[model samples]
Target: MSVYTEVGRDQLIAFLADYAVGELVHYQGISDGIENTNYFVTTDKGEFVLTLFEHHDFGELAYFLDVMTFFFEHGIPSAHPAADRQGRYLKKLCGRPAALVMRLDGRGVANVASLAQCEAIGDILGQMHIAGQQFQSRRHSQRGPEWRQETAQRLLPMMEADQAALLKNELAFQKGYADLDLPWGVTHSDLFRDNALFDGEELRGIIDFYYACDEYLLYDLAVAVNDWCVDESGTLALRHYQALMSGYLQHRQLTDAEQANWNLVLRAAALRFWLSRLQDKLFPREGEITQIKNPDAFLKILQQHRHQPFSVDELQ
Candidate 1:
């Protein structure tokens, strides 16, 4: 996360006046993400998070906010967007589209995640997927099939020979599975460790709904498993995998198609993140504290999933 837009005290005071959140006692820029500008805001009434969209416009972002709202209304742990005095959840701040959301009382898993934490994440994810099935909104992934292929083609020239070859091969391998008959719905496509909040042993909140989109439920699980159940070397940690899969399977059962295509979806998840990291590294935007993650880390992950045929049947 990076502070792309800087808001001054006077500017914030003026912005807060539009909302009936009491007097703003303090506010500070939050430097944790790469997509949007965020700040932790405290007022006499309550604590809230101020987010300014860097990439999404007001129209395009409404779907994501609605998705979060849907989950929160259904008693899920996702944060609720606060409405202004005029009952609008979105407004302009410092020339950027902005909104305020209720901040949860938990922080992300510090450093390595515990087995219980991994299982908890899987449980919440399964629940969210179940909840998402009832949500009527449909927003396709901005970084789905077309973007992945186009981005890989655009970045191949800047990559090492092996990297280029690997990307091409993976893209080709994944292209055929794009239209499988699968259980599809909204997915938290980017549920990395930093995105989930934990209080003690419980996952109290799930933030960063900007990447949530219409996708395969299984693909979403694979995305979560890829990050939550991997080691520093990008290999699967068997116990962590078992815990996560166990947590998810308790809520929903996987079909034979979903089970058969599990490894491919895992590889697809790895490839998507790898291409995105590579894109960020090569064409980064200017921000106060935008983090540029290592592309090679995901490259190793994709290679591991591709070369090693780790069967889902072996998961138990």
Candidate 2:
């Protein structure tokens, strides 16, 4: 949701004319994320998010738009992609592939303060996974093991010997679990606390589906735990972790393989973010508002997961 491309007022008004959303009142650039150019668009009808795709092609963008529609139709609390008079969600805006989605109510929780909040996120995530089972479109995770390895190799030369070794070792460790059979489905691969909207302790919406893909269900849970149930020091908060798992299990129980490889998945999740952040920090794109998250944060998380592995029973 960074501003990579700038949109002029006149240009934006003309673009909005293609849709029935209403006359554009105002629009402001959103700078919380790093992938795409996003703006909070306000029109006479209501508020919406206008996203200009930075890297994705039209076909990829259409898949994501369909995924959002599928989630919304299945009772998942997510933004609905707006269509034009021609009933088309994809359009060319600012000379880039773009789409408009309804702006969900409530703000994203930056500093998750309660176990109840973690639980709520977990419950919703489980429901989302279940709903995604019926979605026919299949896209492999862009940040999966192969990407992690390639990224780590590229970043290795830029880091200290110890950091390079850790990166290599973690990638090797993740490879051991590559073929493990687990319940797989469409997953919100990046479900950090900031991606979820909370009205008090209840979750109002989950936004940012750009990273959604077909992946292991447990891996999705692991990614959530790595973010939502971790403290400032990147240590796993046991109570919060437990609450999250409990809530998820209420909706969909994990398979035997998932339970057995839970700790491994946690480590893999940590490694994924660590590598991505390092890449973003080292090779930042030219954006109007570029935010490079700290790679060290995920490094600490990876170290913790490596040193202190926990099981599903421990969370129970």
Pick by lDDT: which candidate is best?
2
Residue runs of model 2 more than 4 Å from their true location after superposition: none
What is the clash count for each candidate, in the order shown?
4, 0
TM-score per candidate: 0.97, 0.98
Q: What is the clash count of model 1?
A: 4
Candidate 1, superposed: residue stretches over 4 Å from native: none
State the TM-score for model 2: 0.98
How do the residues 30-113 of candidate 1 rate in per-residue lDDT, one tens digit apiece?
777678899999999999999999888998889988988999988888889999989999999989999999999899875667
The alpha-carbon lDDT assigned to residue 26 of candidate 1 equals: 94
